[model samples]
Target: MPTPSAEAVLADSAGDAAFATTLAKGLVVLEAFEGAKLLGNMELSVRTGLPRPTVARLTHTLAELGYLTYDPRVAKYAVGARALRMLHPLLAGMPFRQLARPLMQDLAYSVRGTVSIGLLDGSSMVYVETARSGDVGPHTPDIGMPIPVVRTAMGRAAASMLPEAEAARLERQLEAADGAMWSGYRDLYRDGLRQCAERQFCTCFGDYMPAIHAIAAPLFRLRDRCFAINCGIPAFRLQQGQLEHEIGPRVRALAESIRVLVARPESAEPGSRGAKTQTR
Candidate 1:
């Protein structure tokens, strides 16, 4: 089935069946990681909305190609070092991280909290780098920590731009989550993402952890692909309107600079195989 708008466009261009199928499935696999936790073969079947057998075959093929690695002991898969090795030239060629670091440090100093650079992984956000303010708070996220995407400003910022169906599926996962462990997010839940598409950022108060607030803005690679930057502020120091009034703009600026650097032909790295990059 095609939308009226899509039908008109396809009629005009003449439908290319092979192009459509391959491109669509490739994108499906890519999106499966947008906010997911670790996706095993079965989990990926659910996330990608693909059949189990298809997911298994794709995973097997990707693993053989050095893009994904299967850990038999854990029965899990993560992006292989080969995938990581693929990123080196891209990140190394361009100085996006280097340029952004100074700005992150400056923002951390001004805000008296912590600043971080992250990218979206499957259904979670992974922190690639972090700069903290003298360890002002407990529960500080380490460089490689992964956080639930539906629960963090960084993850929301990235996911907010996705299609509505994707966002809703993530919400279901959030709602289904149980235990006192996540009691903290209930209060901070905003129900729906607002102002994210327009602002290209998301702000959350005490969603990931009690007494911790954060502001996150998306960075871009080309024009629309979302990457992100975020600032973490402890509740103890948060003045009422600071996140929207001050921190938002600063994070957005850092994001913009990063976006510019990442777009350079040499700077954009191929994404990882199993694990996705942190979105924040």
Candidate 2:
């Protein structure tokens, strides 16, 4: 079955008269560029399940509003500076990213791996911040990259932080959407969640991608946002059991440190309580 367009889905599900279907459709067109540099109307239509003509009109409106730019040379649209500017506010709202940066960088160097922060994005876990040891590779997560919610250690650890009912609801949604994907990782997902519950961290070995191993722990927050930290090192870099014995505990501690820093009152300014916390 074809995925319905944003307009159709919203129309059916939304009872509120205040809902702006056209505005949503246009935003959906923009979201079609999630992992792409540029896209044409047809591509946007296919990606968003919106009609081509509708996509064309939406793209034109967005371009007019400075949210998108059109390159006549290739006849494609790219997200504009305005759209990038819009993201700045959202990024600014995450007060923890700044506090976690140095700590994550230190941990990445300590383990010869990459340390990243993951936040729930629908059914995916998106990296909102990252620090890494050396040259980047395909497996090294970058900010804005997303991984499966049930398929990576970071995702599993984050999911484990969810309330039981919320987690079960999400599980049902994912299973209903893609039974094959959910089934393939269901048991492993549960195992990872159990590990997080028991040890406050979970490890993924050669999952999410071949030859990539990672450990993650959730950063429990009072606010609604759920975040996790993942430290990923190539499988070859480890001998055996290093993920659990070394990396897991370090990641868990790092997460707790960050949680405290972010949760501190505004009056408790950095370095005011005492010396700055050192990651080393």
Candidate 3:
């Protein structure tokens, strides 16, 4: 099924007395720009399922609040300065990211893959730190990108490390929230979990995209938060059994190394990238 809109995903939340629906609706308008950098009210209304008038009002408020910027010449809106305000503080504060970067970069260079650290967010995994060979350019995933919890080795690996009760609850929630996605990938995802249990890591071949093949392992709970590390390479570059036999173990070892470092966070200069974690 097509990914549900933010409105559809939050439909049940609207009924809560303290939900602040107006605030949520406004954020939904901003979220309509996910893969899209610019959109007008009609497009925003279509993406969000909000009426055009409501979209207009929310967009106006968002623009006023600096969460969005309006382009009169092109008649569109894009994410604005206020969003970066939150990003700056977040990218500057995480101590684990400082601890993880050198290792992630080392793996990225050695494996010629994009290596990323992702943190759980609601039911998804969002990239916290992403290191790529210089040649990969912008074609690969970046920090702040969100991938589904059950559809990725990164997400499933993280889930596998959770307490049994928490893992089962989140699995049920994901299946219910996105049944089509869950139903399609249930078996493959289960295999990933088994891989995690048997070998401390998971492999995903073409699950992310036809071009991307990846393996992942979780850092489990580190300093009260959970994170996963992933190494993804283009399918064209993947040798036979590379993801399963080679990269998978490498990623698991990377996770273990970071887990040890995170267990004992120390005072150190933030790498040039600084705080590379996001709890949200």
Candidate 4:
């Protein structure tokens, strides 16, 4: 799902009599800091659609709480160390990452592409683990990076695992939020999902990024959690045919291996043949 706009987030809480608007606004301020190194009061006000004075108050409170750091000289705010600390538990305890890292590494090495595992988060696929061979190109994203659902191979693969009704709901939501961009690529996105349903994998050729191509497969784990793994290669390095026929199937195999390992970790060690072996 696309990240909710600050207005939308606040609107959701507006109808509730006891909702904490202050806390919500403070969080929206923190979210505005995403992908940004520093934000001044005016920028935060513009992003959050809050008054500059309100933003200043929230920023000051957040700084005091260790969620944000204020640079007095520049009069800007940045994410604080406490926010990084808050993410440690989520990253450190993911069993899926522990089981999938070695397999992702091997796939990256074999295909000479960056490999990643992502989980559906709201309207985006958030990377949980990523691996890359020593290939010199194709910027590998850091963990926690969010990729839009309707524009990327991994996101499509993960979405394919959803029920038809849920998938349709998500598509409608995306179309509503991303109008022209979603309309332009809607056909390709549908085709990729159909391909994923047919072959258990999906391929994208420069759909999200102009010079990037990827093939991905969905993985299902315990408690109905779903994830996806993909191999991303630079367009110059891999042809469309290779992405569809070779890398696509290889990624599917890796995804299935991960599903098995996650389902029964006691039955397969991380680097053991049972976990690493491609089922076909």
Candidate 5:
């Protein structure tokens, strides 16, 4: 199956009357708040490619709906408490977090590294759960932190799970959207995806963050949603060979174990896989 271009997808969606353009634009206005403490209409317009008037209306609507808070004095908007209230339930509702945290903690302690589980959020991977070893150092994981999808092992692992055509389409879209940033690392990214397809895991060696290396594997759950788990260690502590040959398979096995745990019947045990743990 050939992947459709972004333009085609947008066009198709726009043509559908039930697609709710206004609602989509309102969501876009809310999303523009990511990583930003506050934004004015002009900045929001530029970020979302909506006209100033349209952005004003959208912001007004969002503010009315309690998704955003506006300050007339500063002429800026911030994420409202209502948004956090909505997010709290979603995070607390996921039963898998309770099931997965202990396993992640064990992995982190055994490998003396940071272990995390994440799901794709737009073009970034957002950490949903994390555990860190005592010696994890500066690379501590924070839940809800976003990592670029094209640059991290976890993101690559998720991408590798997509159909070949879809992956290619995504690569094309990324290149078109950010050619300068994408061009320098295109070959490396594609190679990582290929390796992930073959080995069921992906590796990053000081690619996204200097002096940090990680290995990641994809996990699938109900509703066809995909997630990724990664183990990250300082570059000085783990060499590239060790990351690939030693930690790669362990992380892959853990991911498979998590997948089985999620997909299995209620009576099944998640630890049946006997995932190997590293001792330092």
Candidate 6:
């Protein structure tokens, strides 16, 4: 458990009013994403300490307005495109992709795989950028393609960035999913949190895409929100025992560099090549 500061304890004891609780908890559920990771309702329940039914109602309203997405395939939730639209004006003044590209390229080269940056959109992970060693594999997910939050490495790592209570609320979103999807959701949350606490990244094999092996790490903001970067390749082609041995450290390093760049906004110049154009 996190050791709460005196201020935090007092603030909780202040007890917000009913309408405040609804708005506060609703926004808290949305804040669960770091980049690509989506928090399901059950998971949201766990993270936010909000009731499962309350989360369901909140997410339902958000989804109806396209602020969050509900994916039946993975039975998870992600940020909606409309949410991204809201961030556009602020992101426009920043060179987010430029700051990320060099590190992503280095990670892809080191891992001999494809590397990508993703953002959370209501219940889906929107691929913002990518760098591949080459596209020789049978399956290569493209930029703008949305992946289910519960099934992908990027999604879990991103979700790990949320506050513990908020993370719990997002978990509540998972309770409504089908059995197979719920099982995967549970494993990803367990493993993703464990791996993130141990280091900066997590690894997965054939979870998101069959035959694809991947490693992902988080990019943190001053506000404590997290984003994600991932490196992946066809599992069949990787050298024996290379997955964790070589890829993990390299990806972690690249992720750290990106974190540094994000931390120092002055260096994030838009003129840099391979930079992502801010999305609206």
Minimal lDDT window, size 10, model 4: 271-280
Q: Candidate 2 — worst ten consecutive residues by lDDT sum?
A: 271-280
Give the lDDT of residue 98 in candidate 2. 89
Off by over 4 Å in 1: 1-95, 164-192, 221-226, 261-280
Q: Write down the TM-score of every candidate.
A: 0.54, 0.86, 0.85, 0.87, 0.79, 0.59
Per-model CA lDDT versus the true structure = 0.61, 0.77, 0.76, 0.76, 0.73, 0.65
Q: Between candidates 1 and 3, which one is better according to TM-score?
A: 3
**By TM-score, is 2 or 3 better?**
2
Q: Name the runs in model 6 displaced over 4 angstroms.
A: 1-94, 177-179, 222-225, 264-280
Better of 4 and 6 by lDDT: 4
lDDT of 5 by residue, 47-163 (tens): 877899999998998899888999988999999988878767767756787788888888889888999988764456888889998987667778877777778888777666555
> Which of 3 and 5 is the better model by TM-score?
3
Q: Which is the better candidate, 1 or 3, if ranked by lDDT?
A: 3
lDDT of 4 by residue, 248-273 (tens): 88888888787677663321221111
TM-score of 3: 0.85
TM-score of 4: 0.87
Measured with C-alpha atoms, the lDDT of residue 3 in candidate 5 is 29
lDDT of 5: 0.73
Indicate the TM-score of model 6.
0.59
Angstrom error at residue 57, model 3:
0.5
- Order of the predicted models by TM-score, top scorer first: 4, 2, 3, 5, 6, 1
What local lDDT score does residue 180 receive in model 3, on the 0 to 100 scale?
93
What TM-score would you give candidate 1 relative to the actual structure?
0.54
The residue pairs that clash in candidate 5, if any, are none
